[model samples]
Target chain A: MAEDTNSKEYWRWTESNWRDPDIDWKAGEIISVGIDVGSVSSQAVILVDGKLYAYSNMRTGSDSPKSAENAMDWALEGTGMTQDDIHYVVGTGYGRVNVPFAKRAITEIACHARGANFMYGPTIKTVLDMGGQDCKAIRVDQKGKVVAFLMNDKCAAGTGRGMEVFANLLGIHITEVGEMSLRVEEEPPMVSSTCVVFAKSEASGLLREGWPKEKVLAAYCLAMAHRVVDLLERLGVEEDFAITGGIGKNVGVVSRIEKELGIKALKPTLDTQIAGALGGALFARALEQKGRKSK
Target chain B: MKANYGYKDGSGEFFITLDTDRCTACGDCVEACPYGVLEVVDDPVDPLSDVQVAVVTEAERKKIKYTCGPCKPVVDRPPLPCMTACPEDVIAHSW
Candidate 1:
């Protein structure tokens, strides 16, 4: 690939597949990008010498490559790092292969497992990634290799997007749904509407039925968590389970998940959302190590 | 209310499109943008998707598709239906 010599713009399209930015690039330090391109949103994580640098959560735009580029551009803006500094690039998620500039591509399942182990530790066996578009339950050995996995990619009923609707109907923030759910005394009315559109109707009906907001909200959280449970069961969840993806940030959901499965789900400080990116960054580190070993 | 994108003219993945013009400025779009990309605005064609009108100038206008992963199915086609069907309406598919 030709080096973009004129790297003097906030962002400039160097080619259809590449862009140049104004940040100075440094070598020797490993820099990589992990991109999780899902049906709902695309994410980019940038790392420098195996340290967290910057991350971007962007809509997957029209194309995975374009979305990856947009996410990469956003991460660069946050980290003040440039493409030239990146020694290795690993892309994950469904669209990892679509990343035009990625040196290698790995499955998001692997990336998530690798990322979780890196942050939490190698002992994590069961992994649950509640992504924007889907929910996945993966059982892996200590090495972060997939041993068993089940995913609800075909449906979006219980993913991060699902909670957003519950938040809107109750006139509460999405972030609050988990906390509020934890507060409910009753199990609240279970939302039977598996369909998102119909769920809104159901939630509105509950409001008309005069159910307490907390109960109704709690039901929603429990209902969504059930989906994860189902996936985990299918994958045969184990102890020291780790959760990832954007929804992992929701304490309400996480706690409910623990209750439903009768097991605690551990989340790293960065938690589920950045699992794929962290996996990408770790891969960058591994690649650099391999290069040195080879030389 | 919902718009979906087809195989991007250049890039390969199907893109989701949002008719910011048709946006009701209702919080639905705001709630729908899970990545927190869309914000309610007092003005259309401009003012309010990224930042509140007060900070509209500082707001980004580059389609900001980065905010919410749009579901633009096709120009006027029923999107993946899952996005439209999901209660969050996070996915916007023009049917």
Candidate 2:
């Protein structure tokens, strides 16, 4: 059988990295690194004396340890730094335990809360992390410790993976799905099914009924937004909420979630997806400081 | 307190809700589960509470959708073994 050469992976998102030119890592008293190995993606965050320095976001490969190493290597690409220079390492996300160099592994729930606190400031009390395989609603205290939390990982109805499947089904780029969903003429009724398999069939039926691609996207996004809202309500929303993870980049779902919750998520100055890894790095920094004090 | 173990993924919800208040740390559910998904553990929800409660094992929590799939049939689904073994009616499966 001849293999099709024209097939494209529409679900794949662009991976990238960034570093701060101003920061001198050698002068920093403590160099901490955080690696978040999620089911669909991996991110590495480097902090110098508790300040953001460099980071990388990449797709997670089948091997989680290799994915962590890839993300870390990319973050250090132009920094003139090596793994040995990192004083402490914290691993987070679903594959936290797989980070070979990490000094400690922390739950994504705690890490997301801390990361949201740092990125959005101390005022953020609620953190919604919609990751590849799971969605978590966390309530954080002033110090970013989890006060209450709820997680939904069994279903992919409102998660990033669900969005990716939709994008692939629509033969559109994953990044463009959010924008395209918003381009519809008016709001469409949400798809009834919360299960992704059923939702996909429903979407196909809508397309067969002559609904435009944008309208179908709108309906799917609305359904996702409502599903996420139900999860959030279970944990009870608080003031100054923030969103993290890949789905945070999807404006279609975010906007609908904001409308349904009647509260705006804080504008992020840093990449929202890095929240978990950043939080892990922050924890590493704290642990390093504590160790120094003990000595 | 009611603790829900297992996840709701794209396919369906496969949570086993355990009511801790009425649970007497009975090992019946653990014995009844064919997949070894249930276990008796210290009350994780309340540290002060001295009672042990039934919970889905840590390794099985993420994959309960599959571990518990055998008990769930498409038509004429029968009562789950774990739920049936719980004398206090403390276990419920949400499928």
- Best candidate per DockQ, number? 2
Model 1's DockQ score:
0.02
lDDT of 1 at A273: 67
Q: Model 2 — TM-score against the truth?
A: 0.82
Positional deviation of residue A278's Cα in model 1 after best superposition, in angstroms: 1.4
Docking class of 2: incorrect
Best by lDDT: 2
- Candidate 1 segments exceeding 4 Å error: A1-29, A78-80, A287-295, B1-95
The CA lDDT at B45 in model 1 is 17
Clashing pairs in 2: A154-B7, A154-B8, A154-B9, A155-B8, A155-B9, A155-B10, A156-B9, A156-B10
True contacts kept of each: 0.00, 0.29
Individual DockQ of the candidates? 0.02, 0.22
